[model samples]
Target: MTISKHIYFAAPMFANSDLRYNAYLVKKIRQLNHQVTVYLPQENGDINEKSAYADSKMIAQADADEVLKSDLLIAILDGLVIDPGVASEIGIAFAKEIPVIGLYSDTRQQGADNQKKLAALQETAENQFHYLNLFTAGLVKLNGQITNNEEDFLHGIQKFLETGEINDLS
Candidate 1:
């Protein structure tokens, strides 16, 4: 069995719908196993009653600090494009050598031309097309996994927690 560890959950928290999804993901992650605690910036940030600018800076810094101290980071990469803030968090996790797991389920076709689609832009080590930037995908591939659904996400987390490693899912 894997020991308990802290995981930073990074996602776009600016929208109401996104916030709700973040909450749901947190709940599901908590239930995935008894050995992991989730640090969700949307819920843990010291943003209450603060000015917009102050709150934004404080929240961003707090999240970054948590990511640095965390054992792992799970990023939500759903949407037309990866959320800029979440992408930054993923980069930080990579730089810190913390394991990362990316969950992206948006299946909408991204571009009008096949050449412009992310999948067509880069092929994985396994020769499969991944619908994400090569650099971003490569970072996560180093120490963690990228999944698109709840089942795969749970499996990825469990696998990472057990072995401290995961495979490239691209």
Candidate 2:
């Protein structure tokens, strides 16, 4: 029998929106008989300092080690930009030659086609995006980019796993 692939999910955990889609993605991956682990840097950032989840050293080491070990990665690329920690894991997974899927959603509005004050911000954001793409091309290049949003957001995960298609949420 074929072994199920282990998918390491990376995304922002600061907002409820992050958890909404992330939880769904994890659930669906599990349904496919694959192991899913979320590498939240914030959750275990103090591993070396010690608290919950094993000792600090162990926690930090395990977090770093798991990304190196996973078969594939599914990342949420929503918000104004991507999370730095998530980007790091994406790079590591890419070096390991694992499949890295990008799931992005822009929750912001168009700003009535761009006000004068917003123009500078728009240009800067565009420039950053270009550099990000150039820097992390391998893993972040993605099989594709997803652009769908749901009331609950489970549909995004469902679509990502089931279709293997990246819907551009631009």
Candidate 3:
């Protein structure tokens, strides 16, 4: 029998788009491994219901509790910048020695070999790429990895479940 594992999914859950995307990805991850239980914060209506009145301490303590219990954390790294809440979860997971898998699906990260895109980097503020905070990303890399797409992210989870190790997917 497969051993059951718990996962903490950290992402921005304020907007409708973010909510839909988080649910979709969590569903896909569940389909990939039935033995895994993903703790998606948006599902916790007690503290996550925007219509309700949950104070800052309530939200932080609730989410941090789940993060501490997770075997792994899958953080969504797609935004104008890494969501502050997600960054905090990454830090918590790192401090507790839980591995993290960051999904960075920004399209701006493409065109690695395009000469024009590379040349644009010479101009100030003309960089053709999205930047992720290195410190938060470093915390993830110290224990796990950051995947560019969903396919690789799922693969990383599978590998970690089977062997408790993250391979360099670059």
Candidate 4:
């Protein structure tokens, strides 16, 4: 029997491609019968408002509410640098002790367009010995897993469902 889990899907939704990619992931997970109830912020948040501050606050609250209710967070950490909002969401999940699974599907070797930015990120990764931020990586290490491809994400999800635990940080 498969256990049903609620996953807070955190990803970059700044581009049309990103939204489509998120939909693909959601569909694939459902097709695989992982029994996950995904909470996607991009789909749930209220973006259009007269006041910029109000809009931002509303969106933040919506996302935070979902994060608070989720059993775990499935974060797409694909960009050269982690998205600031996603980073903040990760922090919330971490503080709440919710599990986090980081999915780094981008295979490109170039860390950033700028040489200096790339060097800085490389140094940060090397210094902390993590592919991303030390704090974020530590949170994932403590609770869930990290995967780098679609196959791995699927397998990781299955594994997590079965064991209620994950260790795929490889």
* Candidate with the greatest TM-score versus the true structure: 3
Q: How does model 1 fare in lDDT?
A: 0.77
Candidate 3 off by > 4 Å:
168-170
Q: List the residue pairs that clash in candidate 2.
A: 47-56, 48-56, 77-103, 77-104, 146-167, 147-167, 147-168, 147-169
- Estimate the lDDT of model 2: 0.55
Q: Least lDDT summed over 10 consecutive residues: which range in candidate 4?
A: 45-54
**Model 3 C-alpha RMSD to native:** 1.4
Better of 1 and 2 by lDDT: 1
Considering only N, C-alpha and C atoms within 3 Å, which residue pairs clash in candidate 4? none
Give residue 87's error in model 3 in angstroms: 0.2
For model 4, residues 25-110, the per-residue Cα lDDT tens digits are 98887666647788776665355232334466777878899899988788888776787888888889888988888887765544
Per-candidate clash tally: 0, 8, 0, 0
Candidate 2 residue-wise lDDT, 1-170, digit = tens: 33434556777776667667566666665665443344444445555223445664665467668777766566766655567767777777777766666654453433435556355566745422212344554456653333334422344344445544334422
Q: Against the true structure, what is every candidate's RMSD?
A: 6.0, 6.2, 1.4, 5.7
What ranges in model 4 sit over 4 Å off? 45-54, 109-131, 168-170
Q: Which 10 consecutive residues of model 3 have the lowest summed lDDT? A: 161-170
Superior by TM-score: candidate 2 or candidate 3? 3
Clashing pairs in 3: none
Between prediction 1 and prediction 4, which has the larger TM-score?
1
**What TM value does model 1 have?**
0.76
Compared with the true structure, model 2 gives a TM-score of 0.56
